[model samples]
Target chain A: MDSLDDYQIPYGLMAEFDTPADAMHAAEQVRDAGFTRWDVHTPYPVHGMDDAMGLGNSKVGWFTFCCGLCGFFGGMLMIWYMNAYDYGIPVGGKPNFSPFASFPVAYEMTILSGAFGSLFGMLFLNKLPRLHHPLLKNMRFADVTHDKFFVVIEADDPKYEEEETRALLKKAGSKHIELVNE
Target chain B: MANHSVPSSVKIAPPPEELERPALVENNRSLGWISDTVAGVIENKTPGWWKLTFGISLLVSLGLPIGLVYLISTGVGVWGLNHPVAWGWAIVNFVWWIGIGHAGTLISAILFLLRQKWRTSINRASEAMTIFAVMCAGIFPAVHVGRIWFDWWLFPLPNANSIWPQFRSPLLWDVFAVSTYFTVSVLFWYMGLIPDLATMRDRFRKVAGKVVKPAAKMRNKLAQFLYGLFSLGWTGSNRHWRNYEKAYLLLAGLSTPLVLSVHSIVSFDFAVSQLPGWHTTIFPPYFVAGAVFGGFAMVMTLMIPLVSLYKGLDEIVTIRHLEVMSKVILVTGSIVGYAYGMEFFIAYYGGNPYELYAFKNRAFGDMNWSYWWMIGCNVLAPQFFWFKWCRTTPWFIWVVCGFVNIGMWMERFVIVVTSLHNDFMPGNWGYYSPSWVDMITYFGTFGFFMTLFLLFCRFLPLIAISEVKGVTPQADPHHPLGGAKH
Candidate 1:
């Protein structure tokens, strides 16, 4: 029993807020207080919360743009290789390969690849499909999907001091605070 | 300045002429209420009507396989395909179903880009409709090609013969366009569903804890596990949402053009051809307008009853939503009417005798009844929406939507059959009508569509719960309910 208890580590401290405004204000405090490993959780993506949390613009667009370019050129190359270079059959006296004719298909491919990029990029950035997390086991944390908002400051954060962090969260207006364990 | 200071106790009213827009979610429903209402539909016991409808639809949906088997065994001759009227109900049904899919994309993608907050409540179900409708549409072109096995040749894949698909051909372009549209729509729909699925996962977890019966508990546990699996362990983290939102916005941006291109390519199937009526520059825009017109009608057709049948849905999918959709119908329907007139003007003004004859034949030929039906339903039915009473009344909107649905179908029928029935040579002229297999298969698609939709409604969130909450006043940090000072 002592060995098992020794293996357990404190995951984070979670602070519950009644509304998004309260959560946003707390996030601003956490940001200003220089907490690096902390997160705000809410039912939906609250407007202006990004700024409050000090998050810059998301990087998902770069993946989409690069993949979209590949899709378009890949589509064009496939057509050019299959029709013009390899088989070389002409119909209706038109050219074996014309970009005009291939534009629609290539355009479709661009969108398809761009869509793939957006989804996969998001998943990659979020480190999702993890299926397990410390906060997920916390019963009170479940309300983050319903109506409640929560801010979690990880124990691993450099500036994390148990008493000082707890006091700061209390001053930030969180009525309930609990320690989550991993 | 002194006079202005004397009004401390007086109350000033808002300007009478300024009309406040109706709230997106009625009755100022709380966030918990929104989640409960939406998740409750799936978590509660299955309704009798749902079971009955699902059973009937499952049974009726058999006609698709039955008709396909018979058609495959007997051949394409089973359909009403004469020399001139070679393209028949199959093409018409394909275009009709595909067109019906457009409104879903319009709502989910286009409206999102335009920042129309009202679209949040209806976008999920409609996107589901788009996917199913595309499935129905895909069946036609795949089967219409006499050899079903050879349908794989539509792609640019390398085979033994080493021949590639004609990139210039509109028929091949359709293969790429429709396939891409379907794939993108599913991706967008699934992405949107992730957050909502997380909500269901959490709720089911709670339910599993409360249930004492082992078997019932097992079922709840299974549901929770499946939802949790799909939800990808979403924690509603703002860091995750930042990327999630950007991805959603990009998808919406991509889907907007993809949706427009899909119908345009479908229109190209006709327009690129040398056939007098088929070869026209106006085909793309006209077809797009008609697709939007028909798609909204299908949305209304599905949503009106859904709102009424499902308890608590009426508040989320409010009368304002219906009225706004009705206005879209009126606007698009009028555009379709304008296109109809423009087609005639182009035919006469272009001074092509065959084009002239085709237009005249569409109105006065043996198939004239369909043309008039198209006119009555597509052009005139939506005119009722101009009246506030018609727009506000659910039953009236449903009835008008029904006519618009029929009218849109008739419009496709007239376009496909009428123009083709008479060829360049008089000897090629012949009357075309669908065989029983065509009718049954077409009807079966409705069953298939409904079955898929009913299953979606039963298992999934009918309304986008997270998105709907995002639009609510309570979700606003500056709003009083959100704890901001006035």
Candidate 2:
């Protein structure tokens, strides 16, 4: 098995850093190097790392906005359909359907659906709940949720060159760099 | 003489006024220290105090089920509901508990939006409090309807009766507001917990590997798997964090208006009616201010004790946090005081005899003692927070917060009972008081709330570990501790 190690599949090269600054600086170098298939990992979101990585704004707000609009209209329509159209009853001598009467419920529904949109939309975008990633298997990677930070360049990146990438990571101040197995 | 002898060249600029704020996490604690300290409370063996408290709470919590069963078996008549004062302790407790829930959102959502870094230490626990308080609040109206089974009628569900809930009604609006509030709070809270849960999962895995005993290993394995499952296999990838941060911001924004609306809708439950004391245009903002005030007081009441009980939590939840919270209490408490005065001013200036009489009755009538108690507790108790001694002393803050808690309940009592006990017609007026059942049921809710909170403290991260670390100077990329050039 030891002799057959060369045949094992490579997932990516992971470079570990003790501080967010080092990982962020490495991300800037990687971004400048024009690597598209890579990510930085840390226990918390480091401030200003998005620009360092050259990533654009997150698209989550659109999901919330669209769904919130739907919820508001849906709530209004539901009230109108149930009370005014389907089972009309005269109690307070007011109009059968007034937005004023329905605004509170509609507003609440807007928030409810908007929240759902934010959570599910975020999950959808992240491609999460994968449960079985090569990164999860790496003992060194576990610190990503503790105190350490990481930068991983996928083996599938077009500019991939094993030695060259390793040298770049080493140059960027990572003391520990290892190849992750798929 | 020494000053006169000093030369102009030797003159020193008075030390630049030290304006740098206190650190959110005291003692410049490291990231690993933050995680270990927070997760340690859950990972360590249960403390003796926790066992005793949980045992007592579990015993007391049984009163809720027993009281509910008896109430259901007998009838709503078992409560202190009378003809004129139909709404009683149930309504008062509902409003009070719901109001208590508001501080969590205010801290988590409102403070987050405002970029108040100190909130990171207290947000998770307070959010849990909000969820539990809302659960307690939900129970009252559900059972108060006299027909527990028919509570489903509040929703716009299809029914054989071919009747729909009145949309114009504030009661129906309450159904939407509270249920939405609960759902959004849980979502926002769980979303924030995911990364921390991942930390717990990884830590449990590390412990599981080191442990030798089968029982210990199995426990750790179970914890690891549970935390991992809920964590959604979080790897702290920047890609995920990007989306997660955006979602969090959006949720915070959405929740701000939702929190304000919830209490406003609750106030509408009374304000929409024609009752002299109840029908005030100032109800919405007044209720919101009161809710935030009571909620912050409850947060202090719970957190001050927890900070002392848990090891190393004092560094995370520092005196500065308590003092800042006390200032918030003072501000909101003053707003409530203003509302109180404004209500009376409106009552007099409006010149309606009934309104003026209602104000007079509340201040000097049979239930005036409750009014005075409300004033003393809600209005005056937090005034002590203006003093640095009172704000910084944990025991003093705790006592004042206890007063605020009781005062808030009194405020609700004065609002619900006083307003209802005196109708326009002399014949319709009557005195209202709680029965033993009402007292037990309300007491039982405290037990239920405490039981849930204790379980949370024992099993879950009591502080937001990741958020706290993010606020620490070490987490700042440009800070020297983060490897930046000095």
Candidate 3:
């Protein structure tokens, strides 16, 4: 156990709230407290929490839109090269480079890539596929999937003071508070 | 304290009618209650009926590999395919199975995007069905190539032959369309399952009591580990929920178009061809409507049995869900019927002798029996849903859906066989029929689909626990008026 001392670090302090309103109120205070490294968790998406947390509009839509555009052009270019430029053979006596003929494949590709981009972007933004989270070590954290709400302020935040932060969370009406160890 | 009680912005009180109707999930269930109920179903012992169904399905599914071995060794000639009628039961089955997959995506992705709250209980099962049905659909086109080994030729991979897939061809487009549809559906389904799987993980952990013996404790830890692994360490953190919700909404938007495009591209397999009965503009919308119709029938067929078999599930998967799905069947079935009628009218009104003969041949031709079967099952059968009794009764709906499944299959038969059996060149035209290999392979797909479904029911949370809980008023912590009191 002594040998493990070097590996251990202070993960964060987590505070639990009973309702979305309680969590949102706490989140607003924490945001005002100017803690950049923090988050709130709830069972389902609570409306107005993002605004309370001061999160910017998600960049995922842009990623999907760009990927979809690439798919469209990439599909167009592939068809143009294969049908018109490569070994051009007219089957129904139609034009080889007919845009009408290429629309279905291109449209399908656009959607395919757009969907892939959205899913991957979401995963990346959330930093998922991280199978071990410090938060998971706490059994009560599971309630975030069911009923309870939680907020965590990371120790790495510049203004994080252990006693002061605990006092702040207590004032915010957090019923149960625990230190998460890494 | 005032801020903590109820935010001024929250709209917890729903309309007056919401009180008149039964809850989408009955008994005024709480979030904890919903999770426990769904997870309880999975942890319980395999029921005798489930085991029996699985046993029968597994036994019948063996026919698939056996049929395939015979098909590969003996070659495509074992099927009833001839020169003129080159596309036989294989293509028809492909279209039918693929069309059946559409309703799952429609319910999960399309209805979800439309924010239909009632979809929450059923979406999980239907999405799983979409993936399984696509697996069944992908088999026909692969084996239909005769040389099963060279099916990779459908892919546009660079090879020694240096031949890329023809981008202009509808068959090649199907390769892209179906593959993309499969990939996206799986991702969407799995993404939705993560939160629910986490709920299951926690539930199992809770049951693995603290003071239990070492052996029991180890079992609990193992279960927790497995669930945790599948959940990707989901702690339901607020940050994760935000991104998850955004991803879900975006995926829903993408899939709505995908469901429509997939069947339309499948339709192109017929519409792009020069065949008089086949090449028509109506095929795309017509095919899409028919696919949705058939897909809903399959959903109803699967769901009716599931809710009845599981004790607590009937409360979650309420009667309203079935009634709503039945109404969808009625609407889409009518569209399919109208398309069939329009095909005839256009065939006669178009003034082309080839088209005229094709429509005439469909009604009074060699395969006229199939045409009437299609009409009787697809058109006349579902019109019974117009009555409240037929729509609400489970057995009645199931029987009607059975007709729908049969009718849809016959519709495909009428569409494919009728046009091909008599073409412009009378000498080349020939009748199509399924040999033993064709019939066995087709029957085996049902077994394959059911086997996967039973396994899914046994292992995974069949209904989404988290999603169902999310829809309940209890999940809304701040909305005391809307949600159940703590």
Candidate 1, overall lDDT?
0.93
Which regions of candidate 3 deviate over 4 angstroms? A1-8, A90-94, B1-22, B208-222, B481-486
Number of the top candidate by DockQ? 1
Q: What TM value does model 2 have? A: 0.97
**Candidate 1: Cα lDDT at A31:** 90
Q: Model 1: per-residue lDDT, tens digit, B92-204?
A: 99999999999999999999999999999999999999999999999999999988989889987778887878787889889999999999999999999999999999988
> For residues A1-182, could you state the per-residue lDDT of candidate 2 as single tens digits?
45777888998899999998898889989988999999999999998788878888899999999999999999999999988999986776889889998899999999999999999999999997777788888777888889999999999999989999999999999999999988
What lDDT tens digits, residue by residue, belong to model 3 across residues A43-156? 667766887888767778877899899998999888888777876767778888777878888888898899888888888888887788888767888777767889999999
Pairs in clash, predicted candidate 1: none
Q: Which ten residues in a row have the lowest lDDT in candidate 3 chain B?
A: B477-486
Give lDDT tens digits, candidate 2, residues B181-271: 9999999999999999999988887666789999998898899889999999899988889999999999999999999999999999999
What stretches of model 2 exceed 4 Å from their correct place? A1-7, B1-17
**How high is the TM-score of chain A in model 3?**
0.94
lDDT by residue for model 3 (B217-309), tens: 886788788888888877777677787888888889999999999999999899989998899999999999999999999999999999998
Clashing residue pairs in candidate 3, if any?
A41-B238, B473-B483
Q: Which prediction has more favorable DockQ, 1 or 2?
A: 1
